[model samples]
Target: MASTWRTRKADQKTNLAKRRSPNIAEVSIPTHFRCPISLELMKDPVTVSTGITYDRQSIETWLDMGNTTCPVTNQDLEVEDLIPNHSIRRMIQDWCVANHSYGIERIPTPKIPVTPAQASEILSGIAAASRRGETTKCRELAVKVKAFAKESERNRRCFMSHGAGRALAASFSAFAAGPLENSKTGVLEDILSALVFMHPLDEETAWHIGSPESLDSIVLILKCGDLAGRLGAVLVVKELVSANGEWVEVMANTKGLIEALVKLIKEPIFPQATKASLVATYYMVNSDVERMASRFVDLGLVPVLLEILVDSEKSMCEKALAVLSGLLSCEEGREKAYEHALTMPVLVKKMFRVSDMATEFVVSALWKLCKNYNEEEAEEGGRRGESLVEALQVGAFQKLLLLLQVGCSGSAKEKATDLLKLLNGYRGRAECIDTMDFKGLKRPF
Candidate 1:
């Protein structure tokens, strides 16, 4: 009996192997199942008005590239007239299943893109929920909208076209204006999560969120919400400032907003948040707007930026130096930078070590600090500040010389040349000589 059972099991294993061992090349795919444009099997086949079927993605690409005719028929085609060929799609699935032994995997059903009408209906529901103080209902609808945005690029474009950005902004504004409660935090997070998908916000929507109430809400989130929420808030600020330059002033004026942004850099929660905060801060201060620069300086943005330059990666270092350079334009900014212990050393350390843009910014900042360091002051019995001496102490003189030799931008080279001339006055000072490391060589003095 045992021998007979073993023979039966062996026969079953042989049958299974035979079923799984079809040569893929021997099985020919039907030509009709292939997309005329892609020349591959159709996954989501749709028929155009010209009575020709093509893969949906391929046809969409064709139309998006400004072609009004079908690829195969060369007939006038309207994108809206493309209809899903359900029968053909079902047949394709069946064929894949039959060809399972040839390593053919069945394509899953494609998600239907959200129509403008559907997006409008969802936004209306969210608005009604907000009006009735229905936080739970609002959260539910917001999650649904977020899912649609995440489903595909087409759905996100639909949502943006149908005022989803404005509606979400209004919901967030209401939440910010409402009482702060633990139960409502989920609603805020959901709204922010959805809003994040609505990038490149339209001008009106950007202005809508740039309001004082909405700005305050963002600040509140940065202070209290979780990491995702804080990140979303900072990203929104970045988008807003980018979309409209006027919003930068409004953001700069918002109470605690600058402080909150600076704090994110000081004690970073995540890299995205830190970088976004840096970009936002750079925009706000990168103007002749002395008030904005002063605000950043007063909030101690300079030291935090110098600290970032010490250990941050290349991109982060670039942004930090950009913001620091902008801040140095103001009197208070220059004074604050002069006070920091790490300012001179950090600036010199980043010169040739980072990219050219970073080197340029470093050179510009050093020029700003030391351009006024007059040799005439020392000759007139007046004191020369420690900034120039500190520059030499940290090997700024050597770095600048190397920077000029290797070549740099026109502006950067000019600034570096001027910096070399200024620091030359302090090269032989006894204090600089004592603090500077000469390695194995004698002092130039």
Candidate 2:
């Protein structure tokens, strides 16, 4: 009877022990389960070429920071060297489940990663659908591509490596050639959004997108599409135009392309859109300076650029000045600039206040205007001195003198000196002296 009573007592003690919840800190986790890099339990273990396993996040972060060697083994490692260790991940999940009472949660099984082959297959489907004129199907496949890209950085890299950019550019070119209706706008937007995922496009892909049909489609989107679509279109244009001079010339001559870009600058939907439009315009005008500048000037680009210079931030000021400088290379551009009320004053204000680049552009533009004024004065028997006098009226002399006082780039220093001589010629004029601030004036030399 005493033996039976002892057995019952032991059984009760065991039940009580099972009912009690132990603190997680008391559990001894296996060392092998921890990632070598993070020294924590590996959620998604991956083996590298060095035959060492690490948590995927930990090693990817290491590689992204430009380390080409394995953290544990010091062997050369590349991103493609990573291989998922499924057995270890499953073991981790099982361990967490068994330790549930200690507050350990089981890690969910990870989805199979995307591969380059899979990305290429989806792109092939898109191309086939585009060829068949199945707009809806093309859009669905594009969404799938975009979904894959959005899933992870690995997936994006996979898609980009598999010619996703060229495929999407072809698909865009195909659909954009059709009639643009509300239904088609969704299709185009999906394609454009996916294309944006494949950015920093290769030259071949850019060549495809720089076609006349693609440019016309981009212009339409810039005019009528939603904000995201417009931004994507402008950004794509910016990238394509930068690819080659031939593309730049093509974009410059495309009907309504420059006008659409200028409109975006005039009524900016966002800062990036405005900047991208400015960059695109700069490239287009710069390609064929004399002809392209006249086209942009006809679109009232000069006044809009002047407005950006007057009120926008430093970066915008710099880009606006760049476009203005290119535009000033043509006679028509110079005339438009001279006619604008804010041109001289705004240029003077931006000097040394924005950046070295901005100062250079400003000096170049002013030199053009003053030089033109001198030519006109000689041709028209010295009657067209108003622009030169206006430069002095806005304190151009003082700014130029100060620029010379401090220092500037080689080209800017030369332009500033020439401008000083021009302004000095007009210094004794009544309009200049009346508007000049003489207070605290001192010669730098």
| TM-scores of all predicted structures | 0.77, 0.75
Give all candidates' CA lDDT scores: 0.84, 0.83
The per-prediction CA RMSD against the true structure, in angstroms, equals 7.8, 12.0
Q: Name the regions of candidate 1 deviating beyond 4 angstroms.
A: 1-47, 51-55, 82-110, 178-184, 288-290, 339-341, 376-385, 393-410, 425-445
lDDT of 2 by residue, 152-256 (tens): 777888898888999999888887775766777777778887888897898778866777777888888889888988988898888777666677777767787
Worst 10 residues of 2 by lDDT: 436-445
lDDT of 1 at 25: 78
Model 1: per-residue Cα lDDT at residue 34: 95
Off by over 4 Å in 2: 1-58, 61-69, 75-113, 147-154, 177-182, 375-384, 430-445
Model 1: which ten-residue window has the lowest total lDDT?
435-444
